[model samples]
Target: MSIVETVTADMKTAMKARDKQTLSVIRMLKAALMNEKVKVNHELTDEEAQAVIAREYKQRKESLDEFQKGNREDLVTETQAELKVVEKYMPKQLSQAEIEKIVATTIAEVGATGTSDFGKVMGAVMPKVKGKADGKLVNQAVKSQLS
Candidate 1:
């Protein structure tokens, strides 16, 4: 099923189950997806839908970090819950070791010898890693490999 349909079905289920937190997250996702569709004036491919979900997940992670630093346990707990709900829609994340291996290979493939080649390495690596790895993790792996 398409992500929109899957989310719609899950939204109904959440409503029936009285899962308010999940319902709220699903609603936000649906809105984001719909807005993207309207913005682009076309139906979203599965990949586009995944991108939208990934963006939402990234936003949640940033919020989680801020809440943690601010020592807001209540907000941190709530953001963590929302993050879990958003993550259900993302592709499986790559482990750090797995990401490092890919970055190492790509660095060699691109002949990236130093930080000056960071863009070259990242350009080659990002498409390969894409939805499977977080960009921040991939960046760290690339920096470690180069420096």
Candidate 2:
């Protein structure tokens, strides 16, 4: 089944199990997917559906970070739980070493040298890593490799 179908199935499972937290997260995802479908006026491809989930996961990560910075333990705990639920649908993330290797190769391919070529390197790297890696870590990997 497609990711969207999987999300629907999981939503039903969450309901049957009375998993409130998971149910809510899945419902939010379903809403987002519904919005995207309305916006595009068609069913979403698995990639497009996954892109939406990745966007949701990114939002959760950002909120989790902000909550920690504000010293809101309760919010942090809640966002962390939400993140775990969202993460079930994300692609396996690339490790630091893996990101670094990709950055190195992209730099070579693009002939990027030093910090000045930062944009060139990043432009080449982001698409290769895309939903498989976090942007901040990928940025750091690219910077460290360049400098």
Candidate 3:
């Protein structure tokens, strides 16, 4: 089934199981997906759905970090739970090694000899990594490789 359908099905399962946290996260994701669809005036492809989920995942991670820094353990735990629920819909994340390999190949392909070509290298690499890796990690890898 498609990610949207899977999310919907899981929402029902969460409701049935009385999983409040999971249900909330699933509802939030569904709303985000619906908003994206409405904005584009069409049904989303799997890649688009993944993009939406990735955005949600990114938000959760950011919140988790902030909560940790502030010593808000309760919020941190809640955001972590939400992140786990959202991550079920995302692609398997690439490891540091995998991202490094792809970044190296992309830099070579784009003829990016230094940080001067960061944009060119990033444009070429982002699509390849997309939902599979975090942008910050990819950027760090590219910078390390270029320098």
Displacement of residue 42 (Cα, Å) in model 1 is 0.9
Q: For each candidate in the order shown, give its overall lDDT on alpha carbons.
A: 0.94, 0.95, 0.93
Candidate 2 stretches greater than 4 Å from native: none
Sort by lDDT, best first: 2, 1, 3
Backbone clash total, candidate 3? 0
Ranking by TM-score: 2, 1, 3
**Per-residue alpha-carbon lDDT of candidate 2 for residues 26-145, written as tens digits (9 for 90 to 100):** 999999999999999999999899899999999999999999999999999999999999999999999999999999999999999899999999999999998999999999998899
Enumerate clash totals for all models, in the order shown: 0, 0, 0
lDDT of 1 by residue, 1-147 (tens): 999889999999999999999999999999999999999999999999999999999999999999999999999999999999988899999999999999999988988889999999999999998888999999999999999
Model 3 whole-model lDDT (C-alpha atoms): 0.93
**Lowest lDDT 10-mer window, candidate 2?**
138-147
RMSD of each: 0.8, 0.8, 0.9
Residue 116 of model 3, lDDT score: 91
Per-residue lDDT of model 3, residues 1-147, tens digit only: 999999999999999999998999899999999999999999999889999999999999999999999999999988988888888898999999999999988887888888899889989999999999999999899889988
Following a full C-alpha superposition, what root-mean-square deviation does model 2 have from the true structure?
Answer: 0.8
